[model samples]
Target: MKSFSILLAATAASVLPVSAAVAAPAKNIVLVHGAYADGSGWRGVYDILVKDGYHVSIVSQPLTSLTDDIAATQRVLDKQTGPVVLVGHSYGGQIITDAGADPKVKALVYVAALQPDVGESVIGLAKTMELPNGDVEESADGFLSLASDKFVADFAADVPKDLAEFMKASQMPVAAIAFSEKTKVASWRSKPSYGIVATKDLALNANLERWMYKRAGAKITEIDASHVVFISQPRAVADVIEEAARAVK
Candidate 1:
């Protein structure tokens, strides 16, 4: 509670309207982090959305289990006083898919995340498709990690070297088994969906990203960046989230 921060300052470029129509409230935004990253990485997108007069909250996931991450994100959603645009990055796709089932969630935005449907899992999807994290190293205790040496090239290829290095140093370690847990529901199935597909992404297969989006019937936008497109390309990411906000009805 005390650890969570609410970003209210405006900084990033504002979003354009989709159309003039009666829609749900787009005042709240909740961002969920994926594995090998944390909420701090959402600073850029947070600034953009907050500046546009949206109340933005970044969920600090425990990265220990799927249930824990979803619970943490839901807790953040619970604090919002109005409809929320739930956005997730990387493994956070799974988190939002689970947490976004809440009635307060108006829509969903996936940024280079693993969008697993009901009865599917993170590892299950990756196992069927080719992922870009070939250099990721798992520990003996079941926590999965990315090598700091290869983290920059594999996860944040377009990001500056210094920032990528800092991300590697502070990245969260996710429980390897979390990837194997099946999703009970995919909120995108019942909610409006938007996606940011990273063309240069190496951690996730671009085709798989598109496949998931297409299946979910998401409003898709492609960006030429790496896995951490939220950092390398915050504008596009924020724009899609805003679009999701606008799509609410």
Candidate 2:
């Protein structure tokens, strides 16, 4: 009688509905940083996500060209063992918009980042609306960077002064042509997307961010911070990313 009971339990388990076995939530996160900043700026977001049991990786893209940055992002995506919630900040959004098309990417999160549609370039979009701060500097060799004197005011008004200075000192200069290079694809169309708009941003127009996120149909979160929203409001930024991660499955 005991043997027969065991056999009946095994049969019932085999016939259980497939819905009982839900797929695991994505645990990997890949972060991409925009021009003028390195992956280190994602440190705050990284620490928060890690503490919550996520496997996070940050891509340090060379600001030489959009194509090169996309390739750098892809290399990091390739190393992720499972599905990823890809996140990008500032110009890094442009990189992820292209690289997020990778099959490994399950969701996208843009933090005060640019999201250009096909046939659009960063320069083209930025030109659509005037930037609040006019302290951008272009080198004779065709590289672009924020003026050190205005970096804090224009890019990180909410960030502590000393850290902002350090960020300015270590800023990465981008190839001027990168802003003019047109986007080849808009990955958000195929993936679930979330966006954080830094309402007080001076580097990139806040209204432009709204327009782009609206066009992409991303779930948008507005934070009252400077251009470096992730740095200033890491908890809020991480919450949006976690929401995307949980909903992707």
Candidate 3:
């Protein structure tokens, strides 16, 4: 009778749903926001991923120091048990490029984001190409911001007027010193990557976005949107991330 009971218990455990067996190690999606923004920028993307049954988290970068931001991201990466898909937008791209080196990160997705090479600072990368709208401003505090006037036309052109206005009003100040700091490591060099190019992006310039994508050897996806592609096209962003998550080894 005892042998029969043990065999029955083993059979039942083997028949459990994959997701229930050992919890199946949920795949993690870490959303990293760019300059003049916080993790809140990923709210829409986060909501969608949640509905789709994904384990997601957003990294609220201080925008104060590159090392601090990378460390913050790494801290989150360290907590994840399974594979991670690191997604970054705009300057957030720089953060992921360095932080994604964590062994837990299986793939990278750059959404209208910068992908700097080794020894390249944000300024150095920007200088290499001509941007459509020159709207970046350097403040006396040694930080960078977008000129309020250009916020609508350059940063959030595709978004509704009201939301664009809100984004302009709530823009975070990014430390200028952060732009000069070089990424000691760039994960895209070795990891598989996907790049989304905002065709109408005025902040970074569409051409420059494409150039970065090609330079990084990323599988490219183009969207008719502004620099904040994730905000204007959350579904598309989520779809690409979903694809990357499933493809992770």
RMSD to truth, every model? 10.5, 2.4, 3.1
Model 1 sits at a Cα RMSD from the real structure of 10.5
Strongest candidate by TM-score: 2
Cα lDDT tens digits for candidate 3, 174-195: 9988889998888999999999
Please give each candidate's TM-score. 0.89, 0.93, 0.89
Kindly report which residue pairs in candidate 2 clash with one another.
34-92
Query: What lDDT tens digits, residue by residue, belong to model 2 across residues 1-249?
Result: 999999999888886644333366788999999989999999999999999999999998889999999999999998998789999998988988999899989999999989888888999999998888888899999999999889989998999988999999999999998888889989999998998999999999999999999999999999999999999989999999889888866
Q: What stretches of model 1 exceed 4 Å from their correct place?
A: 1-24
Task: State the weakest 10-residue window (summed lDDT) of model 1.
Answer: 7-16
Best by lDDT: 2
Error of 3 at 90 (Å): 0.7
Q: Per-residue CA lDDT of candidate 1, range 117-234, in tens?
A: 9999988898888876677788999998988788888888898988988998987889988898899988898898988899998888999999999999998899988999999888
Better of 2 and 3 by TM-score: 2
